[model samples]
Target: MRQPQQERSRTTRRRLVDAAVECLAERGWNGTTVAVIAERAGVSRGAAQHHFPTREDLVAAAVEYLGEEQISELRARAAALPDGPSRAEPVAEMLLDLYTGPMFRAALHLWVAASTDENLRAVLVPLEARVGREAHRVAVELLGADEARPGVRETVQATLDLARGLGLANLLTDDTRRRRQITRQWARILEPAVATRTVRESA
Candidate 1:
């Protein structure tokens, strides 16, 4: 039936995208290719090309697809956060977890490639911008950050930037022990920095 054929087609496309992301994370952009991804996905080269005519197209789709998956995971985790005065530490840890993962690794590879390839940049710039905006919005919700408060927006953005730096550090070596310590300290600092005070004060 048409329904079964459509479902199978969707499955194959998902496999290709997932394989592309995994390949990007493992083997930098120079190493990832349509043939390799097709092999990893257990699909034929022609099938992969049928879905994504070019390597750039495949990688672009992979980044957008996984970015959404990560965002959805972030939102789901935010809903389950424990209610208490000390939620910042957990939130900080969770946010850091976002950057130090396979998706981030894959995206980093794409970033490096895009830096030199105008064609890749043309495809990636807008995708990353949209992902960045969604990430910022979700971070505000998770941190209970009041953007109206002075420095609060910067504080929230700083947390994400720190997480990214930590993720970059992790790409070279194991930075877990130190990363945990840093995020813990940042959480303590962030709790007050992003606090929404009722009484207005002069800046």
Candidate 2:
């Protein structure tokens, strides 16, 4: 059981993580450090060390923070729309939302740092798989795909591939119409897989 001190420690750790996220957003991964995060969180260096023994561990946690943040936002967007077809709407609209803003950029920056860290890669890779798999699962359920179907792997892979490629394109370019075009195109491609019922319900 966590005592009062331990509970406080946990709170402090959360603050540190939040602060580290801000620092990463503000300074990028190379500029973010234990001392900087501790200062940002209003906790001492010792408290920071107590939570994260190394800067690498801290960076790893920041990547996790980014993933959780993105997933939560995506899921919220998922829930706000209708149940079925509306499900496809979020998928249809992902490019616009994902490519915009500081939060995602910060997360991407941390990801680049985490990708190069072998120790962090172990944790990070699974997180990537989970997000991808979860999105694919959503697509499958919405599409009304019969799991026993032989072509299921190819179907799911298509959604993942288009989403990844379209997202990168959206990020690189400033053309909003082009971004919308890609999403709509992907949505059309996704229609057979997730199903019009899900899209209809969502719409």
Candidate 3:
């Protein structure tokens, strides 16, 4: 049901998007040019431009691409959690893993660059909002947090905020020891608040 040309185009676009994400993660926004992406993707500059006319367009598309990938990864990780009262800590650890990885690094590059570039901001703001919403939804679902409960949503968001802060620390320094310590401590604190039966019973 698909034409050869259309399939080829899709493949090329995927390669370009993947290459752009790698560049953003490793080189930062200032160094991730179309030429470099094209080379990394093994596509001609013309082909890359044909797919993404501007750098902003390419970066925006890459962000969306990476967001979808991260969401899929989150869903898979959440699905792997066993049904039990003790799922909170493992889920929290998984969430922290998601926040501190390469995808997060690529996103940080975008956030930093977008802070100063209006054109990039125009593309990043809505994408960032959507990613945040999805992350919140996945975290709440995985932790079995009842959003309708008075403070449950805030508690879940606070966990994400803490993980994000630790991830920011990871960007500049080796915060592995602190990250583990905080995750364990926070998981203990969140255990009662995010208990599956407790939240469901409250709801």
Candidate 4:
């Protein structure tokens, strides 16, 4: 039996997306090109171009693909969170882990590149906004945050901002111990702020 042409094309596209992310993470934007991604994907440059005519097209597709994957994983992790007072620490850790992964590194490269390139920024800005909104929504759910309460929403957003900052710090060096310590402290501070009782009782 042989695979259908549609399935084959899908596989090729998946490979190209994966390879593009890997290239971005490993080589940054300058070193990542259509030809490099094509070679890494094990497809001809012509085939790669056939699927994504421009580098921006491929990068946009990859960001969109990675964003969905991150959101799906976030939902799964949120479901598995333990039911107890200790949940905040794990929730903090989970959200921080989101930014420390390969996808974030790949996205960071694009962010720096997009800072200077108007065309790339045009392609990336909307995609990044969508991803950021989804991330914030999931963080709210995971934290059991009651946005109806004052400051609760900002607290959740701060956690995400902290995670992103830590992720950027990790790009230059391994600061795992310090990062973990900071998240633990933030979790302590965060738990009381977002806890259901605190939200209801706070005046």
lDDT scores in order: 0.87, 0.66, 0.84, 0.88
Per residue, candidate 2 scores C-alpha lDDT tens digits across 1-203 of: 55998889778878887787788778887888899999989999997898899876776676566556666666665666555544554666763345355555566666677778676566667766776676566555544555565666687677656655555554556556776766676666665654545444456
Q: Rank by lDDT, descending?
A: 4, 1, 3, 2
Superposed Cα deviation of residue 118, candidate 3 (Å): 1.0
Give the C-alpha lDDT of model 3. Answer: 0.84
lDDT for position 155 in model 1: 85
User: Which one wins by lDDT: 1 or 2?
Assistant: 1
Best by TM-score: 1
Predict model 2's lDDT versus the native.
0.66
RMSD of each: 3.5, 3.9, 2.3, 3.1
Q: Identify the superior model by lDDT, candidate 2 or candidate 3.
A: 3
lDDT of 3 at 164: 83
lDDT at 144, model 3? 79
Model 3 lDDT tens row, 130-164: 87888889888888776776788899888888878
Q: Highest lDDT, which number?
A: 4
The TM-score of candidate 2 is 0.72
